[model samples]
Target: MKQKLGNIFGIISIISAVLYAVFFSLSRKQFTETFLVYSLLFLCLYAFYKLSKHAFHVNYRFLSKKWSGRFFNSDVLVLVLAVGVICRLLLLTYTPNLSQDFFRFIWDGNQLLAGYNPYLYLPDEVMRSGASPIPNAAFLHANMGELSSGHYTNYPPLNQLVFAAAAFLGGKSIFATMLWMRIFIIIADVGIFFYGLKLLKLLGKSPYLILLYFLNPFVIIELTGNLHFDGMVSFLLLLSVYHLLKSQQIKTALFLAYGVLLKLLPLIVLPLLFKKLQWKRASLLCLAVGAIVLIGFLPFYSSDLIEKYSGSVALWFGDFEFNASVYYLIRAIGYEFTGYNVIETAGIVLPMITFLSVLLIALKRKNEIPEVLLSSIVFSFFVYLFLSTTVHPWYLTIPLLFSVFTRYRFMLVWSFVVFLSYYTYSNSQFTENLVLVGLEYTVVAAVFLWEVIFFDKNNLQKTKLNSL
Candidate 1:
């Protein structure tokens, strides 16, 4: 009877949270106090359910083990998350404005599929010229009345190519194009979730940790509901790490190369590949993989690829966003953010120093794939976060996903808190607002504290099976 009650409460809490978040997102593209109230209410109910179940009595092994009763609990959590996703998709079709980002992507894809260089034009440009037929097309018409510098198209070509393919398949229907591309991302997210679960299991993650990540409302809503492609990059990275764990050195190199192709940010993990292997072997692997990636990208690689690459690299050091690592710390202290270059120089140098230290430790440490992947993800995430000019909320998924591999439950919680803030940030609802900024910083501080101080390492270790 007690267990049944706990289950009922858990389900109710999840449903409530999902409804609140989805409704809040649709209403104003912002999570107001009312939404937070609902969130808190569900949180309280969830806490009560957990207490009734004596979550403390649940051993880490029971939580971490794959194919266990705990896994069923996780499945229930995922089902609730799926409900959130359904709400998001329904809103995408039914809502008038849908998403600002989605609007931009569809416009860009149409340009590409129409035999025009989308990289050379912004949506506002085409909309003003009466080129796009999508509804509320005037919403894209901007007051600037100037051509954008085409800098935002710096994202890798593979993403744009996939978007173009979707647009082509949808013919002239804008809604169909957007839906198809969104579905593609959703499919990739499924791969990320299941494979991520398997990876966590391999890493000796407790079933609870698996539940923490897989069933986490934040991950599901962001990757599945939002139809974000960050999941593809994350999936590729996890697969790369999995290959490396199996000691498939060449295959690992290829996988990592492909991951970087999907999203260039994964290149940061390259240092880890070299850290353990012989110099000759690492050099050969890098050369082979680099060749493959370059060959695949030959269609998009022009003579100006070098110039474009340099511009993209330089763009990172030109600005500081408050949500980023260490930059938030600096910004919180009243320091003005200069160009991305200046801060990135400092950010990159410091993390490289930290990376060297961690690499030395990693060499001596009996490392599992989960540990290595987690360390790399965290290290690279902060390094780029502090250094990069752009820090999108979806980027947070990179490190957050790997936390499960390390059986870090707090990361899952932090991911959700950060996810909640994303709606406000992306919509510019709280842009430069002091109160929202403070709230964000407070959450960041809490995450840092929870992960560094509160998380128990021994408890994580105890959850692993001997065979693992």
Candidate 2:
């Protein structure tokens, strides 16, 4: 009877996945339709969870043996991954639905291919001047919106290179450009799957644990469907850690640098490596990583690079506030006292706090073991996000990927609730629903606290008992 119920839930999940693809492909711009798609996607995820739970409970030994089998085995693990790949491929045929960020990516890529510095001019300035060097400059400028058009491109150098490759291959068509970008992200995701499985095995965990990341609808939708480069960042990060675990210090340092070049967030993890290596080896790794990062910046190096990039990045702290957790609470308190928004102060102070917190975690945690290092990374990023002024849905990808290695599953819960952040885009005013934001973070925070407090305590007790 339990097996039958599990099978039924699995069928429902598959159907929901297909329906989600259909609706997503048909009307990406319609909020109501998009919401329906998200609803179905979440249902699919929930059903899968139930199916797995019930199946595991019904026949523990059989399910364990089946899931623990090799990659080629005819097991549910293979089936889940196959379904995930199909969902991504189906969405690949459609243009980016969730965000227009890809337009900026294509625009930057075009600028690079045309031998122009993407950082040198704002899109609005270039369009207004009518002397834009990029092909289809007018079209790209119009689509990227005033907010993005007014800011200097702040994407890191390696990201620009990926953009350039896509633009060179896709030419002037938006669909073609999106296709190329999706292909890169999908390939990167495949790399993540390969290394994720290997790392799981090396850590003495079930390889099936990889499905938490690889089969995650949030990852599939955000990275593949929306064309966010966080997927590449996740891939490089996992590969770097895999190499680190294997004691390949040079390869680890090189890949870590590459990950940093893709997204600056990875720089926070450098301190965590200190406890994992000897002082001399750590210094050399740091120097090598620094040199590689500097090399990536050499092409776009200029007197104004620092000024422009810093200015653009500063807007996130001072000017923008969205779906923040602890920062929002602080902002409220400040506003109650000052009769004005206090983001300016909170922005500066919170980042310093986050930096200090990450440093503390790195210094305090025993990161020599792979599992401990992964947990540290997860905790550090959690601190970063909790204190951030802007917690975009895709930003959760880092912690989500890392959490699969640790016993904590709170990040998975965050991934599901993080979709609520997209509710902001449902209206033309771009008005935020603070209630939804609160609910999202509240649930995530509750789960996080439960894991860190109750779950960890119970696990510690079990460990002590087993040792006895």
Query: Against the hidden reference, what TM-scores do the models get?
Result: 0.74, 0.92
lDDT of 2: 0.84
For candidate 1, lDDT tens digit of each residue in 81-166? 35435534543443222224555555556667667665555555565577664434454334112222234455566777777777
Q: What overall lDDT goes with each candidate model?
A: 0.57, 0.84
Which whole-number lDDT from 0 to 100 does residue 448 have in model 2?
Answer: 94
| Model 2's TM-score against the true structure | 0.92
Q: By how many angstroms RMSD does model 1 differ from the true structure?
A: 6.2
Top candidate on TM-score is 2
Enumerate residue pairs that collide in model 2.
none
Q: Which lDDT value does model 1 have at 398?
A: 77
Top of the candidates by lDDT: 2
